[model samples]
Target: MFVKVVVVFLVMVGAALAFPHAPVQQPYYEQQPLMPYEFGFGVQDKYSGQNFGQRERSDGRAVVGSYSVDLPDGRRQTVNYKADKYQGFVADVSYTGQAHHPYH
Candidate 1:
């Protein structure tokens, strides 16, 4: 029993070592830049106390942008998006106005 266990352990270790692990590389969006079309905006309110902004770009290969706004109740909302030749568009949204739900 002891010998069999030792053999199995050694085999597992050998197999793991034989298959060398490779480091993961950055995603295409992170490495490549979207150019040829780029624009951005910013706005602020000193009297009413509100702000909003957006930035967008595309190069026929990829599109990326970010938008943010201030809510009337003093909450902020932001959304980010990215689209590339390889992987389509991906968006991430965050805001304080979102409804809360209890987890089951």
Candidate 2:
């Protein structure tokens, strides 16, 4: 009986020493910097009859942009847009000139 008790105590001690308590960990987060930028681009191909352009600017809080494309009917379709945290996305569309259809 004494030998059995001694063997059990030794086994418990060995287990306690093998597995130590783990320390609690806290979560970490990273912060990013905000930057302002603006850009514009345009493309015009006379052979392919493709004409389009776009311009945009952003100041971290709000964004504004405009784009225009030539329609197959000869009218130019233009769109002006703006977006922010409060009003969300808003756009205005307009057309210039008149459409022409050629007979086959």
Q: What is the RMSD of candidate 2?
A: 7.9
- Report the alpha-carbon TM-score of model 1 versus the true structure: 0.50
Candidate 2: tens digits of C-alpha lDDT, residues 1-104: 99999999999999999997787655442134446889999999989989999999999778999999999888999999999869999999999988898442
Best by TM-score: 2
- In candidate 2 the C-alpha lDDT for residue 96 amounts to 100
TM-score, candidate 2, is 0.66
Worst 10 residues of 2 by lDDT: 25-34
- lDDT of each residue in 1-104, candidate 1, tens digit only: 99999999999999999998998999987786645798999999899676999999887687889999987656678999998868888999998764444242
- The candidate scoring highest on lDDT is 2
With candidate 1 superimposed using the best TM-score fit, by how many Å does residue 24's alpha carbon deviate from the native? 44
Clashing pairs in 2: none
C-alpha lDDT of all candidate models, in order: 0.85, 0.90
Candidate 2: deviation at residue 5, Å? 26
